[model samples]
Target: MTSSTEPSLYAPREPVFPRRVSGPFRRLKWWIMAVTLGIYYLTPWLRWERGPSLPDQAVLVDLAHRRFYFFWIEIWPHEFYFVAGLLIMAGLGLFLFTSALGRVWCGYACPQTVWTDLFILVERWIEGDRNARVKLWKAKWNLRKWRLRMTKWIVWLLIAMATGGAWVFYFTDAPSLARDLVSFSAHPVAYGTIAVLTATTFVFGGFMREQVCIYMCPWPRIQAAMMDDDTLTVAYRDWRGEPRGKKRDGTTGDCIDCMACVNVCPMGIDIRDGQQMECITCALCIDACDDVMDRIGKPRGLIDYLALSDEPVERAGAAPKPIWKHVLRPRTILYTTLWSLVGVGLLYALFIRSDIGLTVSPVRNPTYVTQSDGSIRNIYDVRLRNQLGEARVFRLSVSSDSLLRIDLQGIPDGSDVTVPADSTHLQRVYVTAGPDDAAASTDVSDLRLWVEDLATGDRASRATTFNGKGN
Candidate 1:
């Protein structure tokens, strides 16, 4: 006898035109969308008051100059550890949020969710709400269908273009780049970036929608690791909802089999099917179910933000514990502490960081040149990094044995070197030991290359070696 077993590895997607919902969660989603999109689109245009030589975009990665400016803060290339710290902090923040509230980031602030919501809003406006959309999707393609489809696509394309266009503005001077873009003179890379982002936003937001969350995104799987039995997640109270369905007396369980929650879900997963990985924990189902419960004169939360640990208590016919009681457990406290410490560490590093630095390289080809009168000279290439927002004069001096002296090659001994602000300046200088004043210790002697801020008297130094004839 032959055994038959067939595997359906993939299933075709069923389009989700989530029905319009009105409740606290829906209202909260709208507010979050406004704030997040506003910040993304408008941030590039915000101006800062950095001095004339600096790009004034409030938040800029000045890659050309190897600097980053965020409001009053400026980061030099050498300070990339600050950037790394910020990235780590962001990762920790995600972990903290995930442990506290499962997939809240996914359902609310994730770009995929926000853009998809906007796209669906546009779709519902053009194609009508869920019921009408379903009918239209099944109907034969007529003029109305073609017209509606075309209109929706065009609007989606505009949104995608705007989204991509805003992103590229962050890389350059926003106003100038925008002008250059409109005149078709912006860099090809900018245009290419915009084009790629626009295509992805259009395809992902308008067509793929929740499929991106279910398949393309890795967060859902990773979040499971962060979550535990006590973590707040959207789930059905099966103890109350089950033993459901219609009876002759019209007295069914609170669920009523209305499918209100399923109909309104963006991911189209029925919460009553138990906690599936597909649920974003958006809690719109809670709103829908509550509304139905109200109409039926029953207590709400047949579907709710449930902690699995509460299952025992609720199934015992007692109320679940308060939300804060679950959220303030030991793991969450530890995560919060770590997040706060990293944040405070970054702040401290920013404030106490040096504003000026010096580095010196001794010329090694002919490390020591014997001057005409039995004196010794060593050529040194010195780089001064001035991190201030304005040009500053610096006095360069040396601290070495009493016999040694400092001489900037082209300047008088007492003259100052004018270093341009927010940049590195290189200078060649000579350290000399006169015939009678040759260093007595050794051929290579330790010395200090000191830079003093002329205006403020702040100072920094680099330790170096002076080549002499003392050996």
Candidate 2:
């Protein structure tokens, strides 16, 4: 129905087969992949001794009880500001790293990159490297091809399942969850989350790969804002690489146009075409180009980790700038300062936080109950939180306002109120104003409710008001 002049918005996917190459950058990528994947698949299994009152898992999100435990630190719902501070620091950290090193996190630590590299390793192992993969793609369908394809897919499925399972472990006790998963006894939500994550991992890692970096991720679009002239990124030195051909016949510059860099690039971009948004700056092209340069008996770094600021300098015949010259500029300094301040504030708060907490809510249905002795009484709901691992007795007092006297509903005047380990105790409290004070005071009296741990002397307080009538 459309006119021929209208161009199609969708472009068909062209599969890329990245060639295997050996150089320093390639070795660095291998180490990064190993460490990142190891941390992801193994962290949930780490244990910490938090006593019997809490889970021993070093990192856990106990959603049912509204607690987040990270090793020695346990966070309550009221202290969520600590989590917010951490999130802010994470954002600033990203900005700092992005400004300093172009897409380094994307290349090294991102789960997508790590998993995609793993999938590619499997593919190369089964289907052979770059050239063989290209040939197989064009080859006719047969038993040999189908067998290899099935084997690769099965291996990918196992990895995806493991990835999903590791994520679910963060929300519960890992060993128990593993047992429950095998026995089909886990909660429906757990199973649903695992299933969904498994599907996404399989699709994203095994099939999508670099398409995720190019079209799916928003980081590439925003990364340009983080870059400056002095920011280091993988680059092709066209000054040395241009006028391309082999060297022996006196027909070329240093670059032979052998296409080694293009073949090894996972994003399928020509680094020689200048910087493109599609480049992940993974440095694989640098490895490929350097390998080719070495073979051709030319100085390496035809494609290297260099900065745009150096390009003009090199062209003008000036000495190259030092590596750390512009790295500590205003932007990075501001980011680092902000990140450090939040971390320090959170640490201070954690160190000074008390093990006892108190909250009070006034009951308003009757407002005031006139006592038989002509005194005024107000009912309140008091909640006492015990953060320690052992049960303790807490004494409640309400003496800030001279006219207000406090009493708990169920307990006799002299009895102790006991709070269980890591739990809250709720009591209906009464505030009474004697006839003398009620007769002389205003309609409302502001009062303070304080709770002290009888065993440890830890204390906290909340302020409230007592209703009364004055002449």
Candidate 3:
């Protein structure tokens, strides 16, 4: 039985005081942040010449027009399979990364983590570092503190607003939209989106920081299922650091009970306590521990990223498996293969996709009409899509029995029908078959319609059936 005086297994969580450190990881993080934020803010402004009629924005999701434009590639609402394929590829890529490295995305690449870190940096710049901020929080209200808090809030609001502003640029012609926005002539929906995003960024990045990772994100929950014993995760060298106590002159373990690892953890978790759900595996604690080790004349990596079983075995003088083998395990291989396959398939599909598309729908009201000439006639609604950057002339024809003929009522037969770039044309078409050639009067017979580009000779065909009534 545990006595009242005995220490509880769980200690009250102490707020992290994370001192800034610079290393390879820190440099990589900085570069990633710069690239990601640059792309986010600037991508919508990039222009692609897609003719005068089409939107010039390189990547725009024109939901109102039921179209998506990405540089040279345009996707119609009917081609949602591309979007699905993209999503699948992204998922498989995530799985592959998780299986190989474990939580690197959470630590460095997650938007929440990145934004929260940026907000924290702003707070630190305004209010000073951990100890200073702590002291200010404890002190009574004063003019200096008030001014600092106000400045921090103003900066946060500016950042959040910029984030929102950049997001709105993606949906419209960026330069024109920017001009409209500056003139206050933009849509109210744009303003509403900016307001919502600003509020969320300010609240989540500034206040809800670690809470988002710990409680709100589903990634952490799903990560558990994806991770294995062999996966490399941010971990403490418990075998070497344990029997933890203050260092002596000659006899001692590596740890000096300085709690540097705990103090520098962004999520305020103690690495020495072993892995927990709250750990983002940021490796700031590794930097902290390394600093402490240098100061105490001990080797670094007391708390480091390592495989759980391997670290213990190493401490006990046992050989461990190669890191390569662990990373290239069965699950990782499967995810990698799937990711590659999907990526290749998407690339192939994109390269082979046609600039013209044609779809035909049979008129439902009267499936077939018995003409005065004792022939069968069928009416169809044909939709012609021009996915190119210029208007196209397409010739429509019917192919079935030699006696079958296509008639365009309002338009001339074999005449060039013009379709504007990135636009769809809906036209009424009729197909007629002589009674002698109409294979079966009692049954529906298959008929094919061909739509060909007059200049390029590119063509698309759709099949429909002409219904006939029995005598």
Candidate 4:
């Protein structure tokens, strides 16, 4: 039933050159850039008092030691579930925010958008605005142009290198790392990481720009599915702006076909063409349109933030539902509830989590050995994890019948076993009992091992099974 002449659904890409604009959105962007960049550059230098043996950096990921330290809290390799929980909470928060307002994260908080904006600021500062830069590119080589281009590249490269260098400082003591970097005594991998990050920052922020959001990044596509009609997005009020005509001696409609919105977009997509995939919702176009409206002596917001479902009638009085209701809809409420619950649960777990861990594995080849004195013996490989920041002595004991006893190969009965902080201790342990005290011959036998901290009287236990041969 389909006609053969219908064109394909896809449309070819068109390049955009957005002109600069200044207003509230621009001011918000400036503040965000300052805050985010400041945090990224300065956080590594902040120190926290974590007693004596641990690194003092406020936040550090000590990969060499398999530890993550954030101020007073420290996490070991086995505590990766905490990290996973944080990631889940972050994902849910993104979902909730996206459901309430479209692409707010992409516009305001995304590192890609922030960095690209910074790079563009550098470009504009050195070269000029859109028109001036376009003209400069078309003009022949001259001293003025050469000087500007050289200055821009130098500044951009320095910022890129600094960005990369600041990242590696989080892994070690920031001041010490800085000294090592300057002295050329840092690890080779550290240098390699800096080089890779610097190259990526330059290439992605300077040249790729909108292409990253459009083709390379997956968020835009995922966001489309996540959004609903009620989500507030930067939209063109097509109902009012349409019948768009040039202002010739006092036009009837508000729009003057100035194309200011098109010129100011960083992604270079005409917002008038409906919500396109490339739009990051930066609100720069809102600033541009407002300026145009002010000059033409017309009411602003020919292009503004509006929900897709809320079609504006010609009459000015048709008010939609309250904005808060739209923001706190069912999907958003669900996401927020889940995010909060998980966050609280993770916090509780982290606060009460044990500082010591015990693991016991029974020998497989010979489940039990028969001693000459009519005693049954079993060998176990025990692993102890010390997650604290200081060395501690722990006593190992077995809990069972009174006739049963436990012994460590090199340690005496009831002797203290010294374990260093943030390290694991592995040892062979033997458990013996009189034949009368031994449990019945069964595939599974109940066994419990307890480790007690001698300094603080804190104790932890593990429940395992002692396998035995059939009688």
**Which candidate number would show the highest lDDT if scored against the true structure?**
1
For residues 138-226, write the lDDT of model 2, one tens digit per residue: 88888888988899999999999899989999999999999999999999888999899989999999889888998899988888898
lDDT of 3 by residue, 1-471 (tens): 357999777654444556666666667878888888888888998889888888888999988888899988888888898999999998888888887788888998898988888888899899988789888888888999899989999999999999999999888878898899999999999999999999999998888788788878999999888888888888877767767788575465778888777766789888788888999888887877887888887898787778765876887788777789789889998998898898899899988887778889999787788788888888899989888878899999887754677887678745468898778999888877777764337477777888999999998898888777655
Indicate the TM-score of model 2: 0.94
Alpha-carbon local distance difference test for all models: 0.88, 0.85, 0.83, 0.84
- Please provide, for model 4 over 364-411, each residue's C-alpha lDDT reduced to its tens digit, 9 standing for 90 to 100: 668788788766778889898887778889998887543467888888
Q: What local lDDT does model 2 show for residue 152?
A: 92
Ranking by TM-score: 2, 1, 3, 4
Q: What are the per-residue Cα lDDT tens digits for candidate 1 across 73-185?
A: 98899899899999988888889888988898998999999999999999998999999999999999999999999999999999999999999988889999999999999
For this target, which candidate reaches the highest TM-score against the unseen true structure? 2
lDDT of 1 at 368: 85
Clashing pairs in 4: 18-263, 19-263
Score every model by TM-score: 0.93, 0.94, 0.93, 0.92
Overlapping backbone residue pairs in candidate 1 total: 0
Question: Lowest summed-lDDT stretch of 10 residues in model 3?
Answer: 10-19
**lDDT for predicted candidate 2 compared with the true structure:** 0.85
Q: In model 1, where do residues sit more than 4 Å from their true spots?
A: 1-5, 248-251, 363-367, 412-415, 435-444, 467-470
Clashing pairs in 3: none
- Poorly placed runs, candidate 2 (over 4 Å): 1-7, 248-251, 364-367, 401-403, 438-440
Ranked by TM-score, the better of candidates 1 and 4 is 1
Would you give me the overall lDDT of model 3?
Answer: 0.83
